[model samples]
Target: MSGPFVYVPPVNPVNYPPSPVHYHNSPYLASFYTDPNSPFIPPLSLSGNASPYQSPNTLNSPLPTVLTPNAVPFPASSSGSAFAPENPWNRERRVSWNGSVAAPTVPNSSWLQPPMYHYRRRSDAAAFPFQQPVDWTSLSPYAPYRTELVQQSFIHPLLNAEDRRNDLILDMSCPSFAPMRNIGNNQTAPITPEELNQLAFYPQAYGAHIYCELIPDLPIDIRYRPLPGYSPIAPPLKVGDILAAIWNDMQLGISQEMWASLDENRELMISRAYTKRCKIWASRGFPSMRNAGVKKVDCLLGKVFFRGLVPTGDEANTLRMIVA
Candidate 1:
């Protein structure tokens, strides 16, 4: 009642049209909505007929027919062209532009034929210009042929009939060089069974034999000579002394039979020890066994020591005898 009057504008609410209802008459939707879990349903045609279900894949569609131009047959003969139609089988003959049949330069059969090889005989003068061919017919059967040293070496007059028979038997079984038999005579006696047994047990003696017989008695050149005013830590050793020490050390703890029966590895160890001892002794101003004379003595001693047949006291004497 006490406030001043204020002017107010008229307010009117806007009228809007209602949303239209959507009617889904599509057969696909009708079928789908009928069973949500149903498989795909093709839509009906506008003609009110349910069309047959066709695969959505376009691969099954019938291919469009393509129209091609008709083929024109070739004429039997053409005067303008150089080539003319002929039977495919008749490859050797071709009709020329002038209507004359021409034969091929090369026969058709020759195309598939194998290559031919031509053999040329060398002239005798080109093969052997300086020498004349031997006439085998003119050679006499009784003429003595040049005998080879190897053949001559095999001919031993002392070979008995029994030994020859054994050799023949061995040749039949296993062909090899004839076995060496003892030449029995008053001067040279055959090897005893004991010696054979010893040799069989101590094969290392073969190396001694090789050193004594096969190796030439050439003097070995010394690489290092004894220096003047040089004092050695140990006394100088002879080859015999060095070998004796090695032999003693090899059988120090073991019996003679056990030492002989040592395995290959044990033997190798012993050999290495011997080589070490040699080097050590060489440092003491000793003449090394590398020297030929010393080496020969070493071989002889090696055979004697390994065989264990000679007395230890007589080793030096035996070595001297062998060297002499």
Candidate 2:
């Protein structure tokens, strides 16, 4: 099955009107400026040459000249923008994240090294985990982190003792927000040894990744599937707790970015993720971490309640046969 996917909105509207023009300075801005309420831009010297479209009739007002029918489109400026100079799309971009935090156990990481840092292997599926500390220098917190909090853990607790099975182990599933590489500060600046120890203290405490990197073959969003055995059959008292959380999320949906802030700062994360890469890969999409941008992650988390139109599932053989 594919991953859950959805339609994305355009950053800029289509069939957009030509942007308003902003001449650095127009001599006419003084007498015929369209908006006196707005401060006048300092006038720039127009080369002595006359504009081809400067006609006596249109010259009466600065704003009218701009809308003149015979006006030749302004010569494109090479340095600034493809869209009209005043298009909001041309504004500067600013990316921000939580402040730079040092990991708890700062190992020698490539993040500390110069550009094009080297990456190395750390985790092996066959090997027992948590026997000793993982050398995370080879990995980066900014990259998708894969801790033990994979798909199995999501429904594992809900599983009955007899129904529980680890055969379908998932690696890149529940990613919390904490322990993310410092996108805001450490991105450009080098971290001190002290910050290293602070970041690694318990990276998993941050919470789950917004998008689950489960089965690789499926579309990231459309393929929402959970095993029948995954959801537990809790007795009575626990049902109320589940009901409350459902009410909170369903009736009171939180903004994805706000949730990320709260999730990363939580005293205790429902789960954790490791920065190490796994040796084995899964066939289906499970809840796991993958390289996703903040906007994409926000979109994924925001649609927490979206459902698929087709039959999304992990039963490969059944799906293939149905397609046939």
- Per-prediction TM-score to the true structure, in the order listed: 0.13, 0.13
Ten-residue region with minimum lDDT total, candidate 2: 315-324
Model 1 residue 49 CA deviation in Å:
99
Q: Which 10-residue window of candidate 1 scores lowest in summed lDDT?
A: 168-177
Best by lDDT: 1
* Model 2 lDDT on a 0 to 1 scale: 0.26
Which runs in model 2 stand beyond 4 Å of their true positions? 1-161, 164-166, 172-255, 260-264, 267-290, 293-324
lDDT of 1 by residue, 1-324 (tens): 689976543423211111111221212111112110121122323452333343221354433323312222234535422235554235586655885676744423533433444434457558677765655434423333443553111111111121233221101000111112223221222222222222111111111111122113322111112234443232222222212222222222223564476578756655554454456446645435233112222322233222111212332222111121
User: What is candidate 2's lDDT per residue for 196-298, written digit by digit as tens?
Assistant: 2221111111111111232122222111122344333322112112112211222222235554655453312211111221111122232242332121212
Off by over 4 Å in 1: 1-138, 146-324
Error of 2 at 123 (Å): 99
